[model samples]
Target: MKTSGNRVWLTYVLSDSDVPNALTLCFSLRRVLTSRRLAVIVSPKVSRVSREALSYGFDFVFTLDEERNTAGLENEDFVKLFALTLQGFEKCVMLSPNMLVVKNCDELLDKEEDVQQTFVFAENGDSSILRLRPSLQVFNCLLKQLAKRNGTGVDSILKKWLSDQTSQLTFIDDKYNQHLHEKASFLREEKNIAIVNLKNKTPHELDYVGEMVLQLWKSIYDKSVLPLLNAVANVRNQLL
Candidate 1:
């Protein structure tokens, strides 16, 4: 579950046979990530190529059962397994395969030594942060009302963006965040992404799809939310 001194203090949750992404992750991060810090959780069906590829870079490997869930995709249990690693490793940083870090990703490793949260997520201006921004609340409310009227499909999009991954928002961060929320609090409202924003006068005023969903989830449920606030933030603080 934990590593003694792996370089990046990172882990990846994935099943076997996803060769293309695996290869991409290995090579993309290899130059920056050392052999000891990188690891992959694999299903038993991991191809020999995957195994060899992993062995070439990762310091740790976890083989898991392929038939362990509602779907082969990772879930809460998968998060827990990786969380266990965090419990032991302290500054552990976990990422999915599709997540690509183009900046100071190496800084996440120092989370423990400095006790600061570090991670960078692409800023999609249309994200749910608009709801919390205070300036956009009126506009967002107006947009939601229009959605209710025309059924054009832009309803509370982020709450349901990744329902499969975040069916509910957990209550763990309350103590740190002053106990302002509860478990199973936020569920993906599940809406259509093709909706347009008549609220915006300009065509370029809209945010992208991720801005609608995952960004919202991050606003509400990202206890470990990416902490890339400014371009100058010590990215090495978060882990590359």
Candidate 2:
């Protein structure tokens, strides 16, 4: 496999209900991502309109199928592992859809030069990246570690694995995966958040969560964030 000479940002959208926020996520990345490729793994449950919208923002949009071996994987979560299978990608970063990219995270792209370690994970959120050279081995390690933990979400498994520190993974700063709770006001004024993770929030909850995300975007991209907010509104309209 050849290198894409850059990293690829990977995310998943399992159903039509998740489309708008996922698109919002990719759109924000399009605004600030300087040199990384972007892709999304969609499932059969996604509607045509949502799929078409994804094409606009992602470089490659993979749809799940029997051949993809995604059967029985809750929310098509297993498909994230397939990102390691992509040819020509030197590195791949996986993020949950609810996470909003607030600034250029290209700095996170710098891997340890020796390449002995293959995974770099965020401290506070599910976002993680892997340098591809040893990705297959790393992916296998994760699958084995997580296999018996049925009913447990992939994020939790990886979070526990990385949090242990005894693991071979490199840890990225918590600022890259800032959360929007408990101290939302403080996080806003700090203004150093790179990716905003809205984990476990329902769609209706995202309405309020979005306000904080928009505020961050407003600070970084200025007025350009308005059109993106409008785009999200447009998608919400389609849902209704």
Candidate 3:
């Protein structure tokens, strides 16, 4: 597949079950006309079928090496560290698959270029969205730190790591990573909100905000993702 650009938007899927969410996120980014290319890192648990489906939506579909696929949530967080090892990209915005991009967020890439620090995170301490300048040195350093601080929450580990760094941590606005559990009034009034992190909750489980976001996600899936998935499936069957 062709590269979208030097800067890319990225997500990760640990298993086949996460494919639908990842596709929705990708299509949402496209729907918002995000200029950056899209990419995903899939764990070994994600099957070939899922990877093929992802390739239909993403510019790059990366698989985590088997050795890096350790167990537990901490290990799962460890998988995300691979984003730093991506060689070609000068900058990458890593977002959770459960997030929906509601507005054009190309500014994130532009803003990141101005920052002196190598990493950008939401001020609210949500690791759901991150902007990073990918480097093998940074990735290896974090990997060692993570190993030493095993069992710590990834957010905490990251905060501690940044605290010790010579460069100060740069923070993105909270509107870019709004959580689903925020007050309904806040969700409704936030006109500048660029992305909504669903916290893994389904529409039926949430209030009005959930339904509204779910409708948007469904619209993208039905109008964009579903058709592409169908086409990919048909081609796969024909090849078989």
Error of 1 at 53 (Å): 2.4
Question: Per-residue lDDT tens digits of candidate 1, residues 128-223?
Answer: 111011113333333344334433333233323323334333221111111011112212211312111111122233334323433433342222
Candidate 3, superposed: residue stretches over 4 Å from native: 1-4, 68-75, 185-188, 200-210, 238-240
Ranking by lDDT: 3, 2, 1
Enumerate residue pairs that collide in model 2.
4-88
Q: What local lDDT does model 2 show for residue 49?
A: 64
- Kindly list the per-residue Cα lDDT of model 2 for residues 1-240, writing each as its tens digit: 544455677788888767656766777887784577788888888877677777776788987653544334454557666665655567667777777787888765555442554456554444433323336665566767766777787867856765573445556777666666636543454557677766644334344545666565445434443354457558878898
TM-scores of all candidate predictions against the true structure? 0.38, 0.69, 0.87
* Clashes per candidate, residues 3 or more apart or on different chains: 14, 1, 0
- Which candidate has the highest lDDT of all? 3
Candidate 3 lDDT by residue in tens digits, 1-240: 424488899999987778888999999999888888899988878777778889888999888765652333344586567788888888888998889998998888776343456677788888889888788887777777766665677778777777677355668888888876676644576676789887765555566665777789889989887887788778878989
Residue 174 local lDDT, model 1 = 14
* Residue 206 of model 1, lDDT score: 31
